[model samples]
Target: MTALPHHLDADIWLLHMFSSQAAREGGVIRRKVRDVDRIVGRDAFVTEMRRRGYRVYENAGQFVIFCNREAVRRVV
Candidate 1:
């Protein structure tokens, strides 16, 4: 399982963590989160993500994803 963001609910945090690791391992993070209604209410999750140096945004379909360019640079 993936590590969760501190402010996210158990399910979303787990999903996010898993997707993140998948991406790092050269996999695509291309899943749809069914519990969208559960996430928008939690602003703290957004704040925590930004603080972690990730750039988050919604897609045209309203999916949320995050990435940290600086962190990627450091790793490379």
Candidate 2:
């Protein structure tokens, strides 16, 4: 694959809606979203696990995303 994207993609879509409190530093962790019923909100490009039919993380009664290490490797 090419170099990692410089910016969050604007195309495609995924389920990520973690609350600010859940945001963490260093390394990533999938979070859950609450208001993902609409489209324009998802941050484009679904989480790797979500795409591969894994248990996408969740928190505070919502679907969130943190990065998926294993699924991504298998994809490429």
Candidate 3:
């Protein structure tokens, strides 16, 4: 796995949480970001998500993922 930027720690953690949840219950996962700006910016976050084969969509300060349904599901 490629090293992620230090600033994206929170974003990475957020994804881990969603992935854990998805493993138990498969479907779309939604997580609310109290302040989106406090987390990694959209470009960097999306880039990492894409690299991990996740399809990410942001709406109203929330990041949504239907990761399991994506064509590529492997994280690494």
TM-score, cand. 3: 0.50
Which candidate's TM-score is highest?
A: 3
- Model 3 segments beyond 4 Å from truth? 1-12, 23-26, 33-36, 69-76
lDDT, model 1: 0.50
lDDT of 1 at 76: 50
In the range 1-76, model 2's lDDT, one tens digit per residue, is 4532433232333323232333322234443353343433454334434564444455677664443333433345
Instruction: For residues 1-76, write the lDDT of model 1, one tens digit per residue.
Output: 6743566665555456656775466433432444443543336546655665555455564544444444332245
Cα displacement (angstroms), candidate 1, residue 28, comes to 6.9
Runs in model 2 deviating more than 4 A are 1-26, 29-32, 40-48, 52-55, 70-76
TM-score, model 1 to reference: 0.42
Q: What is the RMSD of candidate 2? A: 11.8
Q: In candidate 1, what residue range of length 10 has the lowest lDDT sum?
A: 65-74
**Per-residue lDDT for 1-76 in model 3, tens only?**
6755674576666566655856447567766654344565566666766765666667887877665644635588
lDDT of each prediction vs. the true structure? 0.50, 0.40, 0.62
Q: Candidate 1 or 3, higher TM-score?
A: 3
RMSD of each: 8.6, 11.8, 9.0
For each candidate in turn, the TM-score is 0.42, 0.29, 0.50
